[model samples]
Target chain A: MIEEETNSRREFLEKSIVGGLTALSAASLFSSCHGDDVKETGEKVKLLSPDGTIVEVDSAYINTNIPELHLSEHNIREGVPGKKFVMVIDLSRCKNARKCKEGCSKMHFLPKERSYVKVEKMQDSEMAAPYWMPMTCFHCDNPPCTKVCPVDATYKLSDGIVSIDNNRCIGCRFCMVACPYSARIFNWGEELYGLNDAEAKAIPDHDACSSHKLGTVEKCDFCPQMGEKNELPDCVKACPNGVFYFGNEYDDAVTNGDETLQLSELLKTKAAFRYLEELGTKPRVYYLPPVNRLFPFKDSEESKNS
Target chain B: MESDFKKEHEKLLDLTKELMPQKFGRTGVIWVISLVVIIAIGLVAYIHQLSKGLIITDMRDYSSWGIYISNFVFFVAISLVGSLISAILKLTHAGWRTPLTRIAEVIAVSAIAFAGLTIIVDMGRPDRMINLFIHGRIQSPIIWDVLVVTTYLVISTLLLFIPLVPDIALCRETGVNPSFWNKKIFKFLSLNWKGKKSQFFLVHKSIRILAVLIIPVALGIHTVTSWLFATTFRSGWDSTNFGAYFVSGAFMLGAGAVIAAMFLIRRQYKLENHITDAHFDKMGKLLVLLSLVYLYFNINEYLVPAYKMKHGEAEHLNDLFTGHFSLMFWSVQFFGMILPIFVLISKKGRKPLPAFLISIMVIIGAWFKRFLIVTPTLLHPFVPIQNVPDAWKSYNPTWEEWSIAFATLAGACLLMTIFIRVFPIIPIWETAEERGIIVDTHEEK
Candidate 1:
């Protein structure tokens, strides 16, 4: 069955390679013939809308909207103005469900085994009870990774997001060694994700979260592309138990899709703390201690297999 | 008095004849061929790596650096020999250093040159190496390393070349049965030296200046290399004594390398008179001193940390002391440091054969020592390794990494071999001058 699946995948890739070329020429030809009159066939078809609802639409109404390009390279380096993004993970609610990991991998187009966020089982001592902690890039205010980068490939932006410019990364991996939390991941080889080079390049740079260059470093980017539209990151939206809360520190407001709370008040009430806070990295991500847990801790399937 | 003068002139002639560069014999030809073959294989592996990525090596996200980086550190460590022998000894007026200075400089140039190349091989994107200069941040220790390594290379090349000018002039004048092309190369490189008193004075002045200038630069190179690790927050790497630790270790490795080269060159060229047993004995003493200094630093670096056994450091120390890497760790310490000190401290062991064997052991041990320093620290990171594939937790270099690493070693040897083939390994003019046989250049012309 696995061999058969691989054979079909290879066949699909081969067809796409050929079909992609034809589509490029056809697109140009259709653009050149734009002034020609169109005659509606008066046909209706069932289609899946963006919201996953079935809809019957006239053929004339069915048109593809090209994805809008946002954030030039310079603009990405500058980051979103007047915003300081932060995150607070509520450890009490987390029970290793792993929906956040799944949603993050799906949104980023990563493979099943690779993920930006990992849910780990943590026990302070042998006698203490274990709890599930979902770990992601802390995006420290004083990022050690950026300081050790030989080239200015990784940098801290004014908006509190630590960003990487893969185009400029020399792939020395010094930044990886310098990161105390092991937040960075290296692209040791090609990560095509089923798209050919040209097809991958066709996606806009800001929106193509998973089209990572070979031999560069990548990590959780806080879903800045979605931030432009004032939407939450995929992991924040995917958690059923509201384990993750993301917000703007400047506005002092944070949300977990189900409720919004004052960031400072919540932190003070919960006695939140950053991981390895003594390192003086000043991480933007905070974690509330797992007190009065809502769900019992259980090992994840992935953890069990390992 | 007249007969004494003629005798001195004839002795100078014999000295030049004995010291001139000779054509390669059967063994030399085989050595060159083997090095070239190794280099060719390495080139093939590097090209494959370029087309693919660093995935050809055993490195992963957690164990991000492997043998290539360790090899780079070894080269950098060995290159420090040039500064130690030529600069420090020369400044101290150690007159017996004449025969070994050129050898030390050649080793430095070749080792450092390959040191730079090995780093590029370790990089995931070698093609984007230009970005290091284009977008270089001065704050990065890597940039400081690059700057200092380049500076040391230039100064070392000059230190090698300037003193060789009078020697090259001798090679040009005597011809030495060199091929036509070699004759031209020698004549051009000689820079029209008349060996006048003024010329000798100028050479000595320049040599003195470079010898003095290279000391701090040499220290900078190794200290900055140490900072590459020390500046990081990793438990094993973070320490105040790292700079002194690396510098002292580099000196020991450098001395070992020089002793090994001295023995081989003495055997190959049949220059028993020039590189005598006394040189070996003195070098043995020097190696013992350096090894002891390095051992002292090693204790300071490891013992204090082991005693405390901080939260994250306990796991790393145990892994070295009694865990998975215990074998390699103990072997490197004993063979690379303790055993060498024990063997070289005795008069019998300071003989050419035993010293050579022990130096070879030191070299091999030094290579693995670097590996121990780099790989183990990475395996035990601050956070526990979990949720990833088990393979990512431990590092084992593949055949490609080994091949490429050996190639860099072979490449450094090949460079030195070619250098010895072209230029006199022992400076002929300087040797004669030291023996008080100052022949008149104008009268000979």
Candidate 2:
């Protein structure tokens, strides 16, 4: 029964994103044809128009094409349904390279100092060896953050993604306190990222994570915009060591960019566990134990400063 | 018999003359102006915050809450005195509470009004406040707080105003040098209170119903406020005992506030006859009892958790007990709780002047105590702090935050000051009746 509901929801999301993109491109195409006189350099470029037809246009007439899909606000909130997204971090494989953090920051248009992913140096006890743990929002099924939100600004979606509506958020910071993982960050000031107000507003809402409204709470959203295109999250794509895996739980398949694996078999064989599992948050992200050393655990310059 | 009746009537008139509202003197004027100045400055700072964002405050992502929240808790705590002095004492049949009820209710109304405002001041988008009502979730503790705070404010205002009807009538009939607007307001608000037997009976019955109603609402307001913290999974805040702990501590703070107000009002208005040494003695005893109860809860909240020394809890407790927050922790405990207990327990300490001084200490201590509850727990989230600026690890409130916090406090005081300037701070008819002077509003002047 639940699967049927999710399938229909997924179809609706796809239709809306495609519909929005078509309208957007049609408007832009009309403006380019009428609003400005085309100076054709006669260098032909084959482009797939919004209707899926190949058309030749002057290279000079081609502005960067609109993103392939533009999920409306309603679609973003409903999420790409029928798939329970999950992530696995193989602790033994991390070498503190921090490419995942860099990639995530770049994709979100976050400032150099702000990042959704943090590569933490963690030591369990006196004798246990320390390891690098890159942390993001756990997207807990029993999300304490969403439960405490007075305004329903942050909510858990059908696709196992915890999302935020900055437009609706009152910026109370209660959710920041409720999340045991310290995963949330606040837009304490105006975050234009050097863009003027008009420029910032011109960026599509789904893609404008960096220009978040002042005083709202924001965190790792798992790159739902990318998910619409069947692409992995930036962190998953950027890891050099294959330490991160992205997958659909219902399909029982998880994949690094290089290798795909069965989820249950991988967990059973590697002794996978969730961070702070005893809290009963039921996190979707799982971690393999740091049993085997990949490289000697050396403190990164960022870790030392912190 | 006729001579005796005339003599009693003369005495009642004298009592009314003594207790009627007075014009502000030079000191009063200065106090009001200074509060206005602070409020103006705070308004400017708040506008700056609104435009620039909460970045003006030193709060980073980790210590997301700061002095604004602590100030909110303090206002909520102090406001609990309304139910303590008026409803609780009245229900308990404490006649000595008569002089203090007006003061307590005024404090409750103003503090609670500002408490609501302070929460807005803390919000990142004060413009989005309407969303709370529109998209409110009943499951959220913040919604619970809003509901209870508003209910308490209404009940408290009614509690303050209902009992003042006969007094307002008395002011209308026989006020000395009342301003033209004051006379008009008194006449409008008096609701034709004639001091008839039926009217007295109605007033008495209404007071009784409201007195009962306010107790549960008062408890709910503070309990819901505490739940905002207790519902969180943080080590320091995740205690089952938070409701009782918060209630007891609030009562202590409220008692301390009442004592301080009693001393200052008595000195300023020369109301030593009404707010006497004996009243101070009783209130001092009440303060000690409340402080002792709060101290017991304090032990439960801290000691048991410390005993377990659970990994997450241990880090948090260590920070409070002997680590970074230790100095503030110990000072608040000693000066705010322990020292007040030790001092107020003695007979000399319960005297008017000494009790007043200790109450001041308690009020100051209680403010910092709230700060301790909010900030320290946030600093020690379950995950270790890493890969952020060092400033994110510790919270230090900036000038803008301080100014805004002080403005709220000043705003509350200004409310009470304006209330006192306009209305009698003590109920005239009630005081006259207690002294066996008959009050007949229908009698011709």
Best by DockQ: 2
DockQ, all candidates in order:
0.50, 0.65
Residue lDDT tens for model 2, A141-234: 9999999999998899888999899889999999998999999998887653454666556656656332377788989988876665667999
Give lDDT per model, in order: 0.85, 0.86
TM-score of chain B of each: 0.97, 0.97
- Model 2, docking class: medium
Query: Candidate 2 regions off by >4 Å?
Result: A1-69, A191-202, A207-211, B1-10, B440-445
Docking class of 1: medium
What's the number of clashes in each of the models?
0, 0
Best by lDDT: 2
TM-score of each: 0.89, 0.89
lDDT of 1 at B419: 94
- Interface RMSD (Å), each candidate? 1.2, 0.9
